[model samples]
Target: MIQVKKETLYAGMLKGLLTTFDLAKIIIPVSIVVTILGKSGALEFLADFAAPLMRVFGLSGKAALALFSGYFINLYAAIGVILTLSLTLKELMIIGVMLMLSHSLFMELAISKKAGCSLFYVLLVRLIPSLLVGILGGWLF
Candidate 1:
Protein backbone atom coordinates (compact mmCIF):
# COMPACT_ATOMS: atom_id res chain seq x y z
CA MET A 1 0.00 0.00 0.00
CA ILE A 2 1.15 3.49 -0.78
CA GLN A 3 1.21 5.89 2.14
CA VAL A 4 0.31 9.55 1.85
CA LYS A 5 2.52 12.22 3.34
CA LYS A 6 0.87 15.17 5.02
CA GLU A 7 3.64 17.20 6.47
CA THR A 8 3.41 20.82 5.29
CA LEU A 9 0.23 22.74 4.72
CA TYR A 10 2.05 25.02 2.31
CA ALA A 11 3.01 21.94 0.34
CA GLY A 12 -0.62 21.01 -0.10
CA MET A 13 -1.52 24.58 -0.94
CA LEU A 14 1.15 24.72 -3.61
CA LYS A 15 -0.03 21.45 -5.07
CA GLY A 16 -3.57 22.78 -5.21
CA LEU A 17 -2.46 26.03 -6.81
CA LEU A 18 -0.49 24.22 -9.45
CA THR A 19 -3.51 22.15 -10.43
CA THR A 20 -5.85 25.11 -10.21
CA PHE A 21 -3.79 27.24 -12.55
CA ASP A 22 -5.27 25.24 -15.42
CA LEU A 23 -8.74 26.40 -14.52
CA ALA A 24 -7.78 29.74 -13.03
CA LYS A 25 -7.30 30.63 -16.66
CA ILE A 26 -10.99 31.45 -16.60
CA ILE A 27 -10.34 34.52 -14.43
CA ILE A 28 -9.71 36.87 -17.34
CA PRO A 29 -13.04 36.63 -19.11
CA VAL A 30 -14.90 36.53 -15.82
CA SER A 31 -13.13 39.66 -14.64
CA ILE A 32 -14.07 41.40 -17.85
CA VAL A 33 -17.72 40.41 -17.46
CA VAL A 34 -17.73 41.52 -13.81
CA THR A 35 -16.20 44.86 -14.73
CA ILE A 36 -18.76 45.36 -17.46
CA LEU A 37 -21.58 44.43 -15.13
CA GLY A 38 -20.30 46.76 -12.44
CA LYS A 39 -19.90 49.60 -14.87
CA SER A 40 -23.40 48.95 -16.12
CA GLY A 41 -24.67 48.95 -12.51
CA ALA A 42 -26.02 45.41 -12.84
CA LEU A 43 -23.56 43.95 -10.36
CA GLU A 44 -25.10 46.04 -7.59
CA PHE A 45 -28.38 44.22 -8.13
CA LEU A 46 -26.75 40.85 -7.42
CA ALA A 47 -24.50 42.20 -4.70
CA ASP A 48 -27.60 42.54 -2.57
CA PHE A 49 -27.91 38.76 -2.51
CA ALA A 50 -24.39 38.00 -1.29
CA ALA A 51 -23.85 40.94 1.04
CA PRO A 52 -25.14 39.27 4.18
CA LEU A 53 -22.73 36.37 3.83
CA MET A 54 -19.92 38.78 3.05
CA ARG A 55 -20.66 40.70 6.22
CA VAL A 56 -20.09 37.57 8.27
CA PHE A 57 -16.62 37.39 6.76
CA GLY A 58 -16.04 41.04 7.76
CA LEU A 59 -16.22 42.18 4.14
CA SER A 60 -18.75 44.22 2.26
CA GLY A 61 -21.23 42.72 -0.18
CA LYS A 62 -19.43 44.39 -3.03
CA ALA A 63 -16.37 42.44 -2.03
CA ALA A 64 -17.93 39.24 -3.32
CA LEU A 65 -18.15 40.99 -6.66
CA ALA A 66 -14.93 39.14 -7.22
CA LEU A 67 -16.02 35.65 -6.22
CA PHE A 68 -15.42 34.08 -9.63
CA SER A 69 -12.45 36.30 -10.20
CA GLY A 70 -10.31 34.59 -7.60
CA TYR A 71 -10.25 31.57 -9.85
CA PHE A 72 -9.92 33.48 -13.10
CA ILE A 73 -7.59 36.37 -12.49
CA ASN A 74 -3.89 36.14 -13.07
CA LEU A 75 -1.44 36.14 -10.19
CA TYR A 76 0.11 39.47 -11.09
CA ALA A 77 -3.21 41.32 -11.00
CA ALA A 78 -4.57 39.44 -8.03
CA ILE A 79 -1.50 39.75 -5.81
CA GLY A 80 -0.78 43.37 -6.72
CA VAL A 81 -4.32 44.55 -6.08
CA ILE A 82 -4.75 42.63 -2.83
CA LEU A 83 -1.31 43.54 -1.54
CA THR A 84 -2.01 47.21 -2.06
CA LEU A 85 -5.24 46.99 -0.10
CA SER A 86 -5.75 47.62 3.63
CA LEU A 87 -5.25 44.02 4.71
CA THR A 88 -2.75 42.95 7.36
CA LEU A 89 -0.53 39.88 7.38
CA LYS A 90 -3.04 38.08 9.58
CA GLU A 91 -5.87 38.67 7.14
CA LEU A 92 -3.68 37.56 4.28
CA MET A 93 -2.78 34.41 6.17
CA ILE A 94 -6.43 33.68 6.78
CA ILE A 95 -7.16 34.26 3.11
CA GLY A 96 -4.40 31.82 2.27
CA VAL A 97 -5.85 29.21 4.56
CA MET A 98 -9.33 29.80 3.18
CA LEU A 99 -8.09 29.63 -0.40
CA MET A 100 -6.04 26.52 0.07
CA LEU A 101 -9.08 25.16 1.79
CA SER A 102 -11.23 25.86 -1.26
CA HIS A 103 -8.99 25.93 -4.32
CA SER A 104 -9.63 23.92 -7.50
CA LEU A 105 -13.31 23.68 -6.73
CA PHE A 106 -14.17 21.54 -9.76
CA MET A 107 -11.08 19.38 -9.87
CA GLU A 108 -11.06 18.50 -6.20
CA LEU A 109 -14.64 17.31 -6.29
CA ALA A 110 -14.18 15.26 -9.46
CA ILE A 111 -11.01 13.64 -8.17
CA SER A 112 -12.59 12.78 -4.87
CA LYS A 113 -15.65 11.35 -6.59
CA LYS A 114 -13.52 9.19 -8.86
CA ALA A 115 -11.62 7.98 -5.84
CA GLY A 116 -14.96 6.70 -4.39
CA CYS A 117 -15.24 9.27 -1.61
CA SER A 118 -18.41 11.24 -0.99
CA LEU A 119 -18.51 14.83 -2.23
CA PHE A 120 -20.34 15.83 0.92
CA TYR A 121 -17.55 14.34 2.94
CA VAL A 122 -14.96 16.18 0.91
CA LEU A 123 -16.84 19.44 1.27
CA LEU A 124 -17.20 18.97 4.98
CA VAL A 125 -13.50 18.31 5.22
CA ARG A 126 -12.50 21.28 3.07
CA LEU A 127 -15.00 23.90 4.12
CA ILE A 128 -15.89 23.49 7.78
CA PRO A 129 -12.55 23.27 9.56
CA SER A 130 -10.73 25.92 7.51
CA LEU A 131 -13.64 28.29 8.03
CA LEU A 132 -13.52 27.61 11.75
CA VAL A 133 -9.83 28.41 11.69
CA GLY A 134 -10.21 31.41 9.41
CA ILE A 135 -12.98 32.93 11.49
CA LEU A 136 -11.16 32.31 14.76
CA GLY A 137 -7.86 33.57 13.40
CA GLY A 138 -9.47 36.66 11.95
CA TRP A 139 -11.16 37.41 15.25
CA LEU A 140 -8.17 36.66 17.44
CA PHE A 141 -5.65 38.40 15.25
Candidate 2:
Protein backbone atom coordinates (compact mmCIF):
# COMPACT_ATOMS: atom_id res chain seq x y z
CA MET A 1 0.00 0.00 0.00
CA ILE A 2 2.83 2.41 0.89
CA GLN A 3 4.62 1.76 -2.45
CA VAL A 4 1.40 2.19 -4.42
CA LYS A 5 0.78 5.56 -2.77
CA LYS A 6 4.31 6.74 -3.57
CA GLU A 7 3.94 5.74 -7.21
CA THR A 8 0.63 7.48 -7.50
CA LEU A 9 2.00 10.66 -5.97
CA TYR A 10 4.96 10.70 -8.32
CA ALA A 11 2.76 10.06 -11.34
CA GLY A 12 0.47 12.93 -10.42
CA MET A 13 3.40 15.28 -9.91
CA LEU A 14 4.88 14.31 -13.25
CA LYS A 15 1.61 14.87 -15.03
CA GLY A 16 1.23 18.29 -13.44
CA LEU A 17 4.73 19.31 -14.45
CA LEU A 18 4.18 18.14 -18.04
CA THR A 19 0.93 20.06 -18.26
CA THR A 20 2.59 23.22 -16.98
CA PHE A 21 5.39 22.82 -19.47
CA ASP A 22 2.97 22.35 -22.34
CA LEU A 23 1.11 25.51 -21.42
CA ALA A 24 4.33 27.43 -21.00
CA LYS A 25 5.42 26.46 -24.49
CA ILE A 26 2.39 28.16 -25.95
CA ILE A 27 2.23 31.09 -23.52
CA ILE A 28 5.84 32.17 -23.41
CA PRO A 29 6.30 32.60 -27.14
CA VAL A 30 3.01 34.38 -27.51
CA SER A 31 3.86 36.76 -24.70
CA ILE A 32 7.22 37.52 -26.24
CA VAL A 33 5.72 38.15 -29.67
CA VAL A 34 3.03 40.40 -28.28
CA THR A 35 5.61 42.36 -26.35
CA ILE A 36 7.65 42.88 -29.47
CA LEU A 37 4.63 43.91 -31.48
CA GLY A 38 3.61 46.34 -28.78
CA LYS A 39 7.05 47.91 -28.81
CA SER A 40 6.97 48.20 -32.58
CA GLY A 41 3.61 50.04 -32.52
CA ALA A 42 2.13 47.26 -34.63
CA LEU A 43 -0.16 46.35 -31.77
CA GLU A 44 -1.36 49.94 -31.59
CA PHE A 45 -2.21 49.99 -35.27
CA LEU A 46 -4.06 46.74 -35.01
CA ALA A 47 -5.77 47.89 -31.85
CA ASP A 48 -7.05 50.94 -33.65
CA PHE A 49 -8.38 48.75 -36.39
CA ALA A 50 -10.24 46.58 -33.90
CA ALA A 51 -11.34 49.38 -31.59
CA PRO A 52 -14.80 49.89 -33.07
CA LEU A 53 -15.83 46.25 -32.83
CA MET A 54 -14.22 45.80 -29.44
CA ARG A 55 -16.07 48.86 -28.19
CA VAL A 56 -19.29 46.84 -28.41
CA PHE A 57 -17.88 44.63 -25.67
CA GLY A 58 -16.70 47.66 -23.65
CA LEU A 59 -13.11 46.61 -24.00
CA SER A 60 -10.19 48.69 -25.18
CA GLY A 61 -8.57 48.02 -28.51
CA LYS A 62 -5.67 46.34 -26.74
CA ALA A 63 -8.07 43.92 -25.11
CA ALA A 64 -9.19 42.86 -28.56
CA LEU A 65 -5.82 41.21 -29.13
CA ALA A 66 -6.42 38.97 -26.19
CA LEU A 67 -9.94 38.21 -27.37
CA PHE A 68 -8.80 37.31 -30.86
CA SER A 69 -6.04 35.17 -29.48
CA GLY A 70 -8.45 33.36 -27.20
CA TYR A 71 -10.94 32.76 -29.97
CA PHE A 72 -8.45 31.60 -32.60
CA ILE A 73 -5.65 30.07 -30.59
CA ASN A 74 -6.33 28.93 -27.03
CA LEU A 75 -6.88 30.30 -23.56
CA TYR A 76 -3.17 30.11 -22.82
CA ALA A 77 -2.34 32.36 -25.74
CA ALA A 78 -4.96 34.85 -24.68
CA ILE A 79 -3.49 34.82 -21.18
CA GLY A 80 -0.12 35.59 -22.71
CA VAL A 81 -1.56 38.60 -24.52
CA ILE A 82 -3.39 39.74 -21.42
CA LEU A 83 -0.20 39.69 -19.41
CA THR A 84 1.45 42.19 -21.71
CA LEU A 85 -1.33 44.76 -21.55
CA SER A 86 -2.33 47.01 -18.67
CA LEU A 87 -6.08 46.84 -18.27
CA THR A 88 -8.60 47.72 -15.60
CA LEU A 89 -10.14 44.99 -13.47
CA LYS A 90 -13.50 45.56 -15.13
CA GLU A 91 -12.05 45.15 -18.59
CA LEU A 92 -10.24 42.02 -17.55
CA MET A 93 -13.37 40.52 -16.04
CA ILE A 94 -15.44 41.28 -19.11
CA ILE A 95 -12.94 39.79 -21.52
CA GLY A 96 -12.20 36.93 -19.14
CA VAL A 97 -15.85 35.96 -19.01
CA MET A 98 -16.12 36.22 -22.76
CA LEU A 99 -13.12 33.98 -23.34
CA MET A 100 -14.37 31.47 -20.80
CA LEU A 101 -17.55 31.15 -22.84
CA SER A 102 -16.07 30.78 -26.31
CA HIS A 103 -12.38 29.91 -26.24
CA SER A 104 -10.41 27.35 -28.25
CA LEU A 105 -12.77 27.77 -31.15
CA PHE A 106 -10.74 26.08 -33.87
CA MET A 107 -9.94 22.98 -31.90
CA GLU A 108 -13.44 22.71 -30.46
CA LEU A 109 -14.97 23.24 -33.85
CA ALA A 110 -12.85 20.45 -35.30
CA ILE A 111 -13.92 18.14 -32.51
CA SER A 112 -17.51 19.17 -32.99
CA LYS A 113 -17.22 18.45 -36.68
CA LYS A 114 -15.80 14.98 -36.01
CA ALA A 115 -18.75 14.39 -33.74
CA GLY A 116 -21.10 15.10 -36.68
CA CYS A 117 -21.95 18.66 -35.68
CA SER A 118 -22.03 21.41 -38.27
CA LEU A 119 -19.35 24.10 -38.11
CA PHE A 120 -21.86 26.91 -38.48
CA TYR A 121 -24.03 25.63 -35.66
CA VAL A 122 -21.08 25.17 -33.34
CA LEU A 123 -19.83 28.69 -34.03
CA LEU A 124 -23.30 30.14 -33.64
CA VAL A 125 -23.89 28.44 -30.33
CA ARG A 126 -20.52 29.43 -28.91
CA LEU A 127 -20.29 32.96 -30.31
CA ILE A 128 -23.78 34.20 -29.50
CA PRO A 129 -23.59 33.40 -25.82
CA SER A 130 -20.12 34.79 -25.54
CA LEU A 131 -21.09 37.98 -27.35
CA LEU A 132 -24.13 38.45 -25.18
CA VAL A 133 -22.10 37.91 -22.04
CA GLY A 134 -19.46 40.34 -23.20
CA ILE A 135 -21.99 43.00 -24.03
CA LEU A 136 -23.81 42.58 -20.75
CA GLY A 137 -20.68 42.27 -18.71
CA GLY A 138 -19.36 45.41 -20.33
CA TRP A 139 -22.47 47.33 -19.40
CA LEU A 140 -22.99 45.93 -15.92
CA PHE A 141 -19.50 45.41 -14.69
Candidate 3:
Protein backbone atom coordinates (compact mmCIF):
# COMPACT_ATOMS: atom_id res chain seq x y z
CA MET A 1 0.00 0.00 0.00
CA ILE A 2 2.76 2.43 0.94
CA GLN A 3 4.72 1.46 -2.16
CA VAL A 4 1.76 2.11 -4.48
CA LYS A 5 1.10 5.41 -2.80
CA LYS A 6 4.71 6.41 -3.22
CA GLU A 7 4.66 5.57 -6.91
CA THR A 8 1.29 7.13 -7.73
CA LEU A 9 0.31 10.11 -9.84
CA TYR A 10 -3.30 9.37 -8.95
CA ALA A 11 -2.77 10.65 -5.45
CA GLY A 12 -1.59 14.00 -6.73
CA MET A 13 -4.43 14.27 -9.24
CA LEU A 14 -6.95 13.40 -6.58
CA LYS A 15 -5.66 16.07 -4.29
CA GLY A 16 -5.71 18.64 -7.05
CA LEU A 17 -9.22 17.76 -8.13
CA LEU A 18 -10.53 17.87 -4.61
CA THR A 19 -8.93 21.24 -4.11
CA THR A 20 -10.49 22.53 -7.32
CA PHE A 21 -13.95 21.48 -6.21
CA ASP A 22 -13.54 23.11 -2.82
CA LEU A 23 -12.35 26.42 -4.22
CA ALA A 24 -14.88 26.61 -7.02
CA LYS A 25 -17.12 28.90 -5.02
CA ILE A 26 -14.67 31.73 -4.50
CA ILE A 27 -12.70 31.00 -7.65
CA ILE A 28 -15.71 31.01 -9.96
CA PRO A 29 -17.03 34.28 -8.60
CA VAL A 30 -13.66 35.99 -8.71
CA SER A 31 -12.94 34.76 -12.20
CA ILE A 32 -16.24 36.12 -13.42
CA VAL A 33 -15.49 39.45 -11.80
CA VAL A 34 -12.09 39.58 -13.46
CA THR A 35 -13.38 38.52 -16.83
CA ILE A 36 -16.38 40.82 -16.84
CA LEU A 37 -15.12 43.79 -14.85
CA GLY A 38 -11.38 43.72 -14.37
CA LYS A 39 -10.43 46.66 -16.49
CA SER A 40 -8.14 49.30 -14.98
CA GLY A 41 -11.17 51.42 -14.15
CA ALA A 42 -12.65 48.61 -12.13
CA LEU A 43 -9.47 48.02 -10.13
CA GLU A 44 -8.74 51.71 -9.67
CA PHE A 45 -11.08 51.78 -6.70
CA LEU A 46 -8.87 49.29 -4.89
CA ALA A 47 -5.88 51.56 -5.48
CA ASP A 48 -7.36 54.06 -3.08
CA PHE A 49 -8.53 51.38 -0.72
CA ALA A 50 -5.33 49.35 -0.49
CA ALA A 51 -2.74 52.09 -0.87
CA PRO A 52 -1.98 52.90 2.75
CA LEU A 53 -2.13 49.29 3.81
CA MET A 54 0.12 47.98 1.04
CA ARG A 55 2.48 50.93 1.42
CA VAL A 56 3.26 49.70 4.92
CA PHE A 57 4.43 46.41 3.38
CA GLY A 58 6.58 48.20 0.74
CA LEU A 59 4.32 47.22 -2.11
CA SER A 60 2.20 49.21 -4.52
CA GLY A 61 -1.29 48.91 -5.99
CA LYS A 62 0.08 46.73 -8.77
CA ALA A 63 1.11 44.18 -6.21
CA ALA A 64 -2.50 43.49 -5.36
CA LEU A 65 -2.93 41.96 -8.80
CA ALA A 66 0.00 39.73 -8.10
CA LEU A 67 -1.52 38.71 -4.79
CA PHE A 68 -4.95 38.16 -6.22
CA SER A 69 -3.65 36.38 -9.28
CA GLY A 70 -1.52 34.15 -7.11
CA TYR A 71 -4.40 33.36 -4.84
CA PHE A 72 -6.76 32.67 -7.72
CA ILE A 73 -4.58 30.81 -10.16
CA ASN A 74 -2.17 27.91 -9.74
CA LEU A 75 1.13 28.87 -8.12
CA TYR A 76 3.06 28.01 -11.29
CA ALA A 77 1.22 30.75 -13.14
CA ALA A 78 2.19 33.28 -10.51
CA ILE A 79 5.76 32.06 -10.43
CA GLY A 80 5.86 32.08 -14.20
CA VAL A 81 4.92 35.72 -14.32
CA ILE A 82 7.49 36.54 -11.69
CA LEU A 83 10.24 34.74 -13.59
CA THR A 84 9.28 36.18 -16.96
CA LEU A 85 9.22 39.65 -15.50
CA SER A 86 12.66 39.23 -13.85
CA LEU A 87 11.73 39.80 -10.22
CA THR A 88 14.43 39.04 -7.69
CA LEU A 89 14.49 35.73 -5.81
CA LYS A 90 13.81 37.62 -2.61
CA GLU A 91 10.65 38.97 -4.14
CA LEU A 92 9.70 35.57 -5.50
CA MET A 93 10.15 33.91 -2.14
CA ILE A 94 7.82 36.42 -0.53
CA ILE A 95 5.34 35.95 -3.35
CA GLY A 96 5.61 32.17 -3.09
CA VAL A 97 4.84 32.16 0.61
CA MET A 98 1.94 34.51 0.18
CA LEU A 99 0.47 32.29 -2.50
CA MET A 100 1.16 29.05 -0.69
CA LEU A 101 -0.54 30.20 2.48
CA SER A 102 -3.71 31.02 0.63
CA HIS A 103 -5.08 29.34 -2.45
CA SER A 104 -8.52 27.94 -3.39
CA LEU A 105 -10.39 29.99 -0.86
CA PHE A 106 -13.83 28.70 -1.87
CA MET A 107 -12.79 25.07 -1.82
CA GLU A 108 -11.38 25.18 1.68
CA LEU A 109 -14.51 26.91 2.89
CA ALA A 110 -16.60 24.09 1.53
CA ILE A 111 -14.35 21.56 3.17
CA SER A 112 -14.84 23.23 6.54
CA LYS A 113 -18.57 23.40 5.93
CA LYS A 114 -18.67 19.67 5.41
CA ALA A 115 -16.80 19.31 8.66
CA GLY A 116 -19.32 21.59 10.42
CA CYS A 117 -17.25 24.70 10.96
CA SER A 118 -17.69 28.40 10.16
CA LEU A 119 -15.98 29.35 6.93
CA PHE A 120 -15.65 33.01 7.92
CA TYR A 121 -13.78 32.19 11.08
CA VAL A 122 -11.66 29.74 9.16
CA LEU A 123 -11.03 32.50 6.63
CA LEU A 124 -9.66 34.75 9.33
CA VAL A 125 -7.37 31.94 10.39
CA ARG A 126 -5.80 31.73 6.95
CA LEU A 127 -5.85 35.44 6.10
CA ILE A 128 -4.46 37.06 9.24
CA PRO A 129 -1.62 34.67 9.94
CA SER A 130 -0.48 34.42 6.33
CA LEU A 131 -0.34 38.18 5.92
CA LEU A 132 1.64 38.58 9.13
CA VAL A 133 4.09 35.88 8.13
CA GLY A 134 4.47 37.20 4.58
CA ILE A 135 5.10 40.69 5.87
CA LEU A 136 7.70 39.52 8.32
CA GLY A 137 9.37 37.33 5.72
CA GLY A 138 9.39 40.07 3.13
CA TRP A 139 10.92 42.50 5.61
CA LEU A 140 13.47 40.08 7.05
CA PHE A 141 14.71 39.04 3.63
Question: Which of the numbered candidates is closest to the native, going by highest TM-score?
Answer: 2
In order, the Cα lDDT scores of the candidates are: 0.59, 0.93, 0.63
Candidate 2: Cα lDDT at 58: 93
lDDT of 3 by residue, 26-117 (tens): 45555555544345466567656776776555555545656666666555445434433444566566766777787657766678888998
Deviation from native of the Cα of residue 7 in model 3, angstroms: 11
- Encode model 2's per-residue lDDT on 33-123: one tens digit a residue: 9999989999999999999999998998989989999999999999988888888898999999999989999899999999999999999
Predicted structure with the largest lDDT when compared to the true one: 2
Off by over 4 Å in 2: 1-4
**Candidate 3 regions with alpha-carbon error over 4 angstroms:** 1-52, 74-77
3 Cα displacement, candidate 2 (Å)? 13
Candidates in order: C-alpha RMSD to true structure: 8.3, 2.3, 6.0
- Better by lDDT, candidate 3 or 2: 2
